[model samples]
Target: MIVVTTPTGDIGHQLVEKLLESGASVRVIVRDPSRLSDSIRNRVEIVSGSHADANVVNQAFEGADAVFWLVPADSKADSVTAAYVDFSKPAAQALKACGVKRVVSVSALGRTTPLANQAGYVTASLAMDDLIAATGVNFRALTMPSFMDNTLMQAAVIKAQGTFFSPIDGDLKLPSCATRDIAAVATRLLLDESWTGQEEVAVLGPENISFNDMADIMSDVLGRPIRFQQIPLDAYKARFLQFGYSEAMAHGMTDMADAKNRGLDLGVERSADNTTPTSFRQWCETTLRPAILD
Candidate 1:
């Protein structure tokens, strides 16, 4: 059995669907079983609690051959590091105690970049990877740049105002993968047990596309004049604070965006092996468009 965390999240949900289709025995640790569809609930063993809870992971990991790990975002956390690394400490320990041999985790790109230490949430994610590696479980950190699915977050703005906002420069092209592509890669890794040792699986998308390009794509896809607005770093942090993030947590979000605008996310070059199949436009059509319409 493979233990999956965050199984109801965007990518996790897709990964669970793929694993189910593959006829694999799957188990999930979830905070709310009700969030799971009736079909999913009937198919998999469910541990009903946050995976950050040691008890939940310990119970879920028992007899599991591999695990899909993801630290769900906690917007109200006091610090980004606490949200990522500290929150994952229990689950990492449980992986070893439960004798799980393999783990595939969702992580970030920019390991070799100078900003790794200062990239806020990205820095915390990388640190979480190191902690997981310390457990000696065969680990694959499926690293990715900005997610195209993030567009869904601003869907209401796009629909109402015909625009979206970001701290990153609109003209600066950077790799961004769709969450579905990331899930596809994760599903492939979790199903295959032949791979061992700790490594980063870079799931960059098909190409590097800029926010300006995204606007153009959105305009075409939605048949409306959508625009990309670059908000100031201070404004970005303020926005997070408005969302109830603590001061430190708000700074972390802005710092991560600043690092990305400076090209830290592009530290890892895209290639045939690392790049996944989804493009920004394809994501716009499949994911973003439906959300805006809704």
Candidate 2:
């Protein structure tokens, strides 16, 4: 049996679907089963509660052959480090106690880069990989750069005003990934237990794409003149804060944006195995276009 955390999240939901199709006996730890579709609920064993809860992880990991772990961001968190590293402590302990053989987790790139220690959110996430690895479980950290799917958050602006915004410079090229691509690699790792020890699998998308390039692709795919706007870091933090993010988290986000703008996410090189199949234009056509249309 494989235990999956955040089964209803963008990546987790897709992972669950693929695992079920492979006829794996899947189990999920979810805060609310009601959010899951009837088909998923009926198919996987449901352990109802947050994975951060020790009791929940202890119960969910029992007899599990492999597990998928992800520390979903909590905007209301008191501190940035607590959100990733602290949230994963229970599951780390459970993995040791349960004797699970493999763990595939969603993580970011820049493991040994200088920014890994300074960038608040990335620092915490890299620390999370360390905590999990200390348990001696065979781990594969699906490290990725900025997600192409993040543009969906600005879909409304794209549809209404033909513009999207970010703190990164519009001309600076950076690596990107689709959640679908990440899920594809993750599901494959979870199913095949042959690989051992800990490793970071870079899941960079097909190419490096700038926000300006993305706007051009969106314009072509959506048949409209879409543009990229570079908002100030303070403005970006204010927007997230307006949505109820804590002061610490909002600042952390701004720090991460600054680091990315400075080429922090470009530390990883795009290669055959690491570069996933989805191209920016392909994702814009399939995912971005539909979100804007809807």
Candidate 3:
């Protein structure tokens, strides 16, 4: 059995569907089973609880062969470490106790970069990877840059004002990916049992494109002029705080943005093996266009 966590999330839900399509026996740890569609709930073995709970994970991991692990973002987390590493502590223990054979986890890029230690959430995520790796399970950490679907967060604003905002330099080109590609890669890894040992799989997308370039694609795809606005890093943190995020979590986000701006994600060179298929234009057309127009 392959156990999946956060099965209702953007990437997790897609991964679940792909796994089911591949005829994998699936089990999911979810907070609310009702959040799952009737079709999905009927299809998979449901362990209804937070995967972070030791008892829940122990029960979910029992007789499981592999696991898809993702720590849901906690804007109200007291600290970055507590949010990622601490939240994962229970599952790490459960993995050993249950003798799960493999794990595929969602993580951020920047592990090899000099700025990794100062990159806030990225730093914590790398630490979480280490904690899991120490358990000696075959593991793959899907390290990624920003997700293109993140743009949908500003869909309403883009529809009304024709603008989106970020702290990263608009012209500083960097690799970004579609969540569907991430889910596809995760599904492939989870289904294959031959690969062993721990490694970071960098899902760098098809190409590196900047925010300004993305704005151009959005303009063309949505049939309206859209603009990229680089907001102040402090203001970015302030925006998070305004949204009710804890101070530590807000600073963690700000630091992550600052580190990305300073080339944290530039540590890896793109290659065919690590690069995924989706491009900014394709994502803008298929994903962002509908979010803005419809």
Candidate 4:
């Protein structure tokens, strides 16, 4: 059985569907089973609880061949370490106790750069990968840059004002991926059992494109003039704080954006093996257009 955590999330839900399509026996650890469609709940064994719970994961991991692990973002956590590393501690222990063979996890890019240690959430995620790797299970950390679909969060604003914002420079070209591609890659890795040992799989999207380029694509696809706005890092953190995120978590996000701006993600060179197929234009056409227009 292949166990998946956060099965209701954007990437996890897609991964579950792909796994089912591939005829893999699937089990999912979810907080609420009602969030799953009736069709999905019928098809997979459901372990209704947080994967961060020791008993829940231990039960779910029993007799499982591989696992798909993702730590849900906790904006209210006291610190980045608490959000990623500490939350994952229970599952790391469960993996060893249950003897799971393989794990495919969602992580961020920037492990090799000197800025990694100061990259906040990315730093904690890398530490989480290390904690899991120490357990000796065959592990693949799918490291990625920002997701193009994240733009969907500003769909309403874009439709109303024809503008989007971020702390990253509008002209600083950087790789951004689509979550569907990430799910597709995770599905492929979970289905195949031959690969062993721990490694980071960099899922860089087809090419590096800046926010200005993305705005152009959005404008063309959505039939409106959309623009990119670079907000101050303090303003970005303030937005998070306004949403009730703790101070530490807010700083973590600000640090991550700052590190990205400083070339933290540039540590890895793009290659055919690591690059994924989705481009910003294609994503804007298929994903962003609908979110803004419909």
> Which digits, one per residue and each the tens of the lDDT, describe model 1 over residues 121-156?
999999999999999999999998899988888888
Error in Å for residue 168 of model 1: 0.9
In model 1, the runs with Cα more than 4 Å from the true position are: none
lDDT, candidates in the order shown: 0.91, 0.91, 0.95, 0.94
Better of 2 and 4 by TM-score: 4
Clashing pairs in 4: none
TM-score comparison, 1 vs 3, better candidate: 3
Q: Which window of 10 residues has the lowest lDDT sum in candidate 2?
A: 111-120
Highest lDDT against the true fold, candidate: 3
Model 2 clash pairs are none
The residue ranges of model 4 lying beyond 4 angstroms of the native Cα positions read none
Q: State the number of backbone clashes in model 3.
A: 0
- Candidate 4 per-residue lDDT, tens place, 72-152, comes to 989899999999999999999999999999999999999999999999899999999999999999999999999988888
The whole-model C-alpha lDDT of candidate 4 against the native structure comes to 0.94
Rate residue 47 of model 4 by lDDT. 93
Which lDDT value does model 2 have at 2? 96
- Looking at model 3, which ten-residue stretch has the lowest summed lDDT? 285-294
Error of 3 at 228 (Å): 0.2
Per-residue lDDT for 260 in model 1? 92
